[model samples]
Target: MTTLSHSPRHGPTRAVLRLHRVPLWVWTVLVIAGAGGLTWLYALGQEAASYGACGGTGMPECATEMRYWGSEHQSAKLLAWLPCGIAACAGAVLTGRELEHGTATLAWTQSVSPARWLAAKLAVPVVALLGGTTALTLMFRWVWGAGPDGGVNRWNSEYFHAAGSVGPAYVLLGLALGAPAALLTRRTLPAMGLALAGIGLAYHLGDRFRSSLWPASEVRGPWDSALNHVDQLEFGMIMESGERVSGLDCSDQAAPGDLGTCLSDHGAVDFYARIHPTSHYWPIQLVETGIALALAAAAVAAAFWVLRRRLP
Candidate 1:
């Protein structure tokens, strides 16, 4: 009689890979394409930088071309949304489809337990997404650093997250949110929809409150002073009594020669801006990444709980 081996090492992971090979390949292609595109953009940025300035002997169109390139390159923006796609895939393909078609149930009845099956489903994608996003992040960072300092705003949502740890954190959050959505819906379409909606809300909330994640720097000076380099969060008038009032309240509509007189009338003596300097980039990134990862951990725990509760 032939004896059957009972070791479960890597079995579930291999099964997951076999089942989701299509998505895996698609992800691989996307990462490769993104890296290639960034490389091209980096070369263009270097060319632009070589041309000192618009008025210099360098190409007359350099400034305009660089501006267009910066505006047109959407790779960073797309990478930022990787989490949403991951969430949708996790909900619709990894969990929902299998559960809907009874494939997950059949697997549970075999040597693979429900927990192991779910673990593999989540683990494989986590590793793939983490690695892919990290590579893209590093490449994007390299490209951004190569460009002129003023080429792109470091605090722009897409550039900021894509160039830091927050990118992978967001992707993980998507996967975490997706699995629970699938377990709850048990139907591919509904699961995908729910996961997408959840990730969308998270994205919106994160973007809306991102600047507040860390304390912002304050700059006070004349209204026309050189304060445009930083990401300004709020602008106001500094009152003679040291009170700060909204910039809107102190309008510049006053007569040009009487601007100072008008401001004095409103008790305003100077202009103040609450801003985030370049130094705050990493602090804000770290804080947001921490929050995203915490949410992902909670969602993953919920997924396992739901799976365990539903299983016999």
Candidate 2:
């Protein structure tokens, strides 16, 4: 009898691909949509700029201005939320459903081994997720930086993570997180919900404390139009006595002539603020990306641990 090969070298990987075809397609569409959307918006940016910069103009005169901001906002939201969305799907459909339906168990019995099964399950998606998000991040980064005065604020919560290396890290975190969630819950819907909630909370907390990831630059002087463009974390008056106070009570309510006296009464001698300049963009992105990757690694480890315990 002719000898028949018993084991397929790529069996597990093939099974993962066959089972997760939907997510694969969804991811493919998302990559295309994100790149295409950013491309279209970049083109729109050029058109919007041709309107000749409507500073201080009213609504009607600022149509192009409004359109540009609108496009940017839409783009920002899409880029920002897409990772969390994928994480949820990964948790629910990719991992959770597989375990819930006992397919993982079936695979293990078919000589796949629990570890190799999980590897195939995770590795394929992780590679695709990282590659796709990285490509999108680079595309959007270009869109943000290429045009004159068209760049998104590097410090903006919505745009900051989306336009940098952190974007792919976030996607990887979502994928990694989904693994433990699915392994633990072993149910599709609950795992999806939990994974999404975890990712969303982590994202929000990261945003809330982003300014503190690195030391902020301090600027002290009279408040002027120039300071308006900064990403201010804190701003107030510095008292003559070397005390700082918030500006809640130091506004237009004070009589124009008494403003100096009012500020003086509050012991204000100068204005100071903690801010992040565009120069710090890369540092913040890198630090946060490291944290995201760390979390992702931890999640993947936990997933493997859970799988081993469950299987053995």
Candidate 3:
């Protein structure tokens, strides 16, 4: 007698997907919006590039081009934060609701073990989070270029989190943080609020320590030099005795000849700045990504521990 087996390998996963289809749809919309935003930015960039018809640097047409590009670039920047927003929504809206509404326990009674159920729930969102964030990261990198251009500095706080693997890493952390938050709170609104607060705190810490992750390049020069202005972490004056003092009052109102004497009186030999150049973008991104991933892993571990402790 031949026995027919009807068990499905992805029953739990399918259930998870079916239950959270709304978030999946939202995620899809975000990905599409991100791609569309990049495409729009690319077109704007092309138009701005075209207006560079003049041969010189200070032309009126070139100024107008930069102004237009700046406006569009600022608008496009909002797209970079989309991944984090999606992660928050997924955590709060999808996972939290299941725990809050007792659906998780209900599923377990139907032969879906709590562990498998949680695994399915987390796995589906994670896969979606990774794919969505990665696509957006690659697209943003392409649109924004590998390094700083015009006004988009890779080292800029917002762009640093948005540009590469760092953005996705933070989203992953959010995804991980959400699960634990939901499990802990067991309420939709509270879980979401907790998750967002956690993510925000992580962002703040990441920003605070970003500079220490990599050594900044120090260049000695006049403050007015164009090269020293971009991605500068610290600006100061170098004293003759080699003491670097920050917060020099170098303003346009300073008399031309008096400026030099003032600087000398303030023990400054030359203007100096600590900066991260375009070359440091990847190194910074990779290091920060590692930190974010570590946090995510910890959060996931904590979530499972919480689940095991709370449920049979």
| Cα misplacement distance, residue 312 of candidate 2 (Å) | 5.4
lDDT of 1 by residue, 1-312 (tens): 998985677888988899889988988998898888888888777766777565643455566555635543577788788745775566456888888898898888887889899999899988988898899899988887777555456677777777899888888888888888888888888888888888888888988999889998887755442555567898878878888887543455544667677677777887778899878888888999999999999998999999998885
Tens-place lDDT digits, model 3, residues 1-312: 999865766889888788778878877887887788777776666666666554567886676567655754564456446567668657766667877777778888988787787778789988998997788767766766621246544566676766678888989898888888888888888888888888889888888888888889987766564663257778878888888888775775366677787787787778878887777778888998999999999998998899899995
Off by over 4 Å in 3: 1-7, 53-76, 146-149, 224-229, 253-260
- In order, the Cα lDDT scores of the candidates are 0.79, 0.77, 0.76
> RMSD of each candidate?
3.1, 2.8, 3.3
**Which pairs in model 2 have colliding backbones?**
239-267
Per-candidate TM equals 0.89, 0.89, 0.86
Top candidate, metric lDDT: 1
Cα deviation in Å at residue 267, candidate 1?
A: 2.4
Clashes of each: 0, 1, 0
lDDT score for residue 5 of model 1: 81
Query: Which pairs of residues collide in candidate 1?
Result: none
State which candidate, 2 or 3, has the greater lDDT.
2
Clashes of 2: 1
